[model samples]
Target: MILIANSEAWPGFSKSIECLRRGERAVDALVAGICEVEREAKVRSVGYGGWPNMLGRMEFDAGVMDGATRQVGAVGAVPDTLPVAALAREVMRRLPHVMLTGDGARRFATELGFPIDETLHPDSKRVWWERLQKELSPEALAAFPDIPLAPLSHAITDPERVRDNTVFLGRDSAGDLASVTSTSGWAWKYPGRLGDSPIPGAGYYADSRFGAAACTHTGEMTMRCGTARTIVLALRLGHSLRQAVDLAVEELKDLRDGFIGGVVIHAIDADQTHRVVSLNCEEPIHYWFWQEGMNEPEKRAAERV
Candidate 1:
């Protein structure tokens, strides 16, 4: 068994391996593992205290994939719930649909016994205010309290500051692979904006035949390129794991509309060998991984592009 996840999800590594060691299905172990990350208050880009939207509300998004069946479930713009990862799993298991969004997602989560709260933690709200202040002068903000922040307008806010995504991938004893991705979506975004996090084959993908791939960084690039799936497909077509990731990173070079600050990809081959790749990243990238015979999860730096 093997588990690989973005470095931000380090808190989940041990628990995920434990679930795998206990013989849980790859999907189950992956979900169980990410739940720890989602519940962690320190990771503000994910569940719970994640950066809020322009309206000061925390909306979350998550996706889950089952490699053996190629099935997926996703939830977007869900508010006040840290269990969206589990909810995505429930959607895959109990619902015929692949996704739910906004109020519908929140309603479904509530029906599934997930908590619903609109109150942002003080620290989270403070973070929101600080970001807002970066885009608006104190006088302008006070004069137009009802005005919505427009991140798309170069004259307004800097959207780059809000970008973040997280991912987790696992392969079970039988070699079945599965993946999960969760994010608060773009910070200070429009009230109901949805990103690649809840988009299948965008945020993550897995196939028992070739293995799994998942990513963190620019969601729009992933959504446009189907990056995670692209990596796995490259592997299926005979590219080495690192080569597959490199091809995906190379594709990002074609992006011309905006700056791609960074991108990090985590991949695991059918043999359970794993590789992490980072493209144009400003700092060193790291990821967490674990397998049988390992006493604890290990953190390793990725190959930088």
Candidate 2:
């Protein structure tokens, strides 16, 4: 058994491993793990505590993949819902679709009797507003919600670029692999921005025969390169876990234009070999890792490539 996840998943690291031990499928166990993070208000980058968009509204994105069948489901730009990761899993289980967005996703949530959470934590909203007030010009601030966001889009992103979105991957004793990505997305983003978190083969991909992979931060570049899928394909073609991750990072380096930022990848291969690597990241990245015999997951720095 093996589990690899970003630091944001620290709150629920043991829950995931225990789920695997309880005889849950990889996908189910991972979903359970991430749901813990989503429920946390202090995290501030996922679920209830997620930062609001420019309009001061909270929207979330989530994706889940089942490696055995390569079946996937994702929801993007959703609002008034907590833990959309579970909804994504349900989409994979119940619907014929691979992705759902906006009202469609909300309607599905309603069908499932999910409660609405439009009232985001006041601190998250206040911080978003304060930052926007500081960044926007007097005229832009005067225009406010009535203003066209496109003109101010360039000024509204989170200045720190702190992407704490959750990406969790696990390999069970049954040789099953699964991946899940859940995020509030880029802080102060345009209302409908859908990052790679909800896009399969970009933010996440899994195939039990080969391995599973997921990404965090810098979703735009990952979407363009299909980073997660590319890593799994490398493993399928007989590359070691390290080699596969190296190739993915090389692909990121090849990009000369478009949104370029740091990316941290978490992956586990069929033989339970796991790796975490960062690309173009200014700061060192750390992730959690655990195998069957370990009493607790280890926190270690990612290899910066």
Candidate 3:
């Protein structure tokens, strides 16, 4: 068994590895792992105390894929819920729809026994206030980064300096593959905006016949290119894992000179081989990796190209 996740998922590494060791399905292990991170109230990028939208309301997004069965589920723009990834799994098992959003998502989750509340974490609220003071324009009561002076104008300054998302993929002992992605979307983003995390074939994809791939960072570019699915399809076409991921990164280069904010990929092939790639990101993108032969999960870093 093998599992790989971005650094934000480090808190859940041991638990996820335990699931894999017990011969759990890859999908189960993936969700179990991400739930740990989601439950953490201190992480500003996902769940609980995560950063809020520009309107100072917390919203969440999550997605999951079961490669063995080709079943998928997703939820976006959900408010006041932390275990969205698990809710997504429930969606895969029960709901007829592939995605749900906003109050509708909250209602569905509540009907299905997920938590619901209108309270915001104190820290998250504080951060939202700080952002308002720094980024909001009193004249318009809108974030400076979101204003438009004219059609097709480049007047709006980008507020996002860096973005983070948690994406994980696993191959179980039985060779079944699965993936999950979760995030609070871009910090101080427009209310009701959904990023690649909740979009199938954009931020994540899994197919037991080929492999699984998950993406993080600058969700817009990934959404536009359907990068996660592209990587897996490249593997289906006989490209090496490294080659496929590299090519996917190449597609995002036009965003800004040769960078697209930041991008990272975690991938595994049917043969159990794994690869990680980063674009315009910090060097040595950290991730947790564990396989059958390892004594314990290792905190490894993948060099960005």
Candidate 4:
């Protein structure tokens, strides 16, 4: 049995779970699916050619988890590595440590046959240069004091609003649970700023036997409080996935400063009961659910009870 949930988009993960039911292992299929999406989606947060850093360079971060074995692997602050999900998967297979960062992560990727190149895509390079110009101009700085232009100076200079925080979850028959989370971090972020995306329990989590996987968006706050883990634990306490997420959100709201982001929680009980919860302040919270072998995914929206 497998289940997944996120803030906005669901097709990629829903499709990946369908592939897994056809006899593929959860870890392999999920990672591969996410990698493909990361590359093709080109959403400026995940994958190559999307966004660059304040220094006009592209970097990536990703993580994978195996719930059955309780093993985890992650890479942070990596440069020029496409298919970062694959690298995170490799880290799980090759390294004993749970996390790797910076040059170490890059070295691991190279050892696994990944190419590191200095030539970034033209679009991303141009975005980076424009950010540089913004920083050089004192008028620009004075205009947008709240924008972290200095940090995210390399990519996504435009002031844009992101709606739902997308979360994807998948599980396999063998009860192997795996999750992959990739992001370019915040726009105009500092050169080496790492976000919740690459951090397990913040961006994603899985428990193979218990049948749960979760991922989060709007990282600035969730990363500080282990939001995913909190939701999972709430579910373990016999709360429905929706109940758990609601509680977790309430708790996080109290603890948070002005930070904002969203979370997607997926859980399957031992009885094969499944549920998903998506929470964000931008709009009403949302939910989804499915049982084992079910073909259709159910949907619901949050409203004041």
Which numbered prediction scores highest in lDDT against the true structure?
Answer: 2
Model 4 lDDT, residue 270, Cα: 39
Q: Enumerate residue pairs that collide in model 2.
A: none
The C-alpha stretches of model 2 lying farther than 4 A from their native spots are none
User: Poorest 10 consecutive residues of model 3 by lDDT?
Assistant: 149-158
Model 2, residue 27: distance off in Å is 0.5
lDDT of 2 by residue, 14-42 (tens): 89999998889989999999999998887
TM-score, cand. 2 vs. native: 0.96
3 or 4, greater by lDDT: 3
Best of the two (1, 2) by TM-score: 2
Top TM-score prediction, candidate number: 2
| Clash count, candidate 2 | 0
lDDT for each residue of candidate 3 in 1-305, tens digit (9 for 90 to 100):
88899888976778888999999998999899898898787665777647776666788899999999889999999987888899888888998989989888889888988767553678767866765565446864454545542321222222434367798899898889999988887776667878899898899999999999998887878987889999999999999888888888877774554225778888999988998877778545888888898998888887677
Residue 124 of model 3, lDDT score? 69
**What lDDT is reached at residue 213 by model 2?**
92
- TM-scores for all candidates? 0.92, 0.96, 0.90, 0.79
> How accurate locally is residue 48 in candidate 2, as Cα lDDT from 0 to 100?
80
Runs with alpha carbons beyond 4 Å of true place in candidate 3 = 117-119, 136-162, 254-259
- Model 3 alpha-carbon miss at residue 121, Å: 2.7
Q: List the global CA lDDT of all models.
A: 0.82, 0.89, 0.82, 0.63
**Residue-by-residue lDDT tens digits, candidate 4, 1-305:** 65554433343555666667777777776676666556654454566535665565667777777767767788887887767777888888887787788788888888878887552567767765665665556765565444555444333443343312334566677767666676655655567877776777776776765545455456766677776677667766777766766766676667656655554445544345555555554556665444466788766663422
Off by over 4 Å in 1: 117-119, 137-145, 151-162
Off by over 4 Å in 4: 3-15, 117-119, 138-159, 162-167, 256-258, 261-280, 283-305
